[model samples]
Target: MLMIFGTWASQVMSRTLHEASIAEKYEQWMAQYGRTYEDNAEKERRFMIFKDNLEFIENFNNAGNQSHKLGINKFADLTMEEFKATHTGYKSTQPKSSKTVSPFRYNDTEDVPSSLNWIDEGAVTDVKDQRQCGKGITILSFVSSYY
Candidate 1:
């Protein structure tokens, strides 16, 4: 009975350590990619959701008889409904143009001009942090227009 209790305790400790290591790795990845949350509670919630989705995707990918391809991406914190609503909302509201015009064609083989500095030409912009209010779209649009 003592040996059994010792083995169980060891297993529990090992699992706890493994989970801690996984959480550490996740935090590191988030920091490297400049991800942040409003507060500790939000961060913990998102991390839990990310872990569950990652495990599900890994299992699906490893299944022998699976036909559909399953992969993990940065949007694991978002649910399917939220993702669809955000991305697909524009599709239904697209305005139709009555004029039929020839599409402009570009020559892919042509080299870019040697004197072109993309940064100066307004191709790149500075990053701005939008805290709490979720006004990222408005900020980005204003910045792009100003540049």
Candidate 2:
């Protein structure tokens, strides 16, 4: 019947429009991050990850109570495991030594402040952002704190 055909056509049209919108969004995200893929398969895989990350970001931002918000960055296309494995720096290949347990030394629990702020007391350094590679901010901060 004509009515059935119209309903099916409208559904198909809506799906097509949705797909187009998603593709456009992904394209814009890729452009913003200067991303590219070697092939369609890889692109599709990364696109799915990007979509999931976007959804997470949106949900976090939509929450009523939050101190900060998240945005799409250069690492948006990576899965959580893949991101941790790649960005977590070097891994040791050495064999493990025998474990040893030590008894507790500090027995006094009184006269201690509820909170500590080493940064405000000039005992520790402040937090810094490392957007790029090979700047050596962490160890340098520790050394400067002592020096």
Strongest candidate by TM-score: 2
lDDT of 1 by residue, 30-119 (tens): 876678999999999888887887778878888868878776556677666667667544354446697787665753546555464445
Q: Please list all clashing residue pairs in model 2, or write none if there are none.
A: none
Error of 1 at 87 (Å): 2.5
- The C-alpha stretches of model 2 lying farther than 4 A from their native spots are 1-18, 90-147
Point out where model 1 deviates above 4 Å.
67-69, 90-147
Q: How many backbone clashes does candidate 2 have?
A: 0
**TM-scores, in order shown?**
0.52, 0.53
| Each candidate: RMSD | 14.0, 9.3
lDDT tens string, model 2, 1-147?
Answer: 999999999999999998788788899989998899999999999999988988899899999599999988888899987776687664556665878766766655676666666777788777666665534545334322211
TM match of model 1 to true structure: 0.52
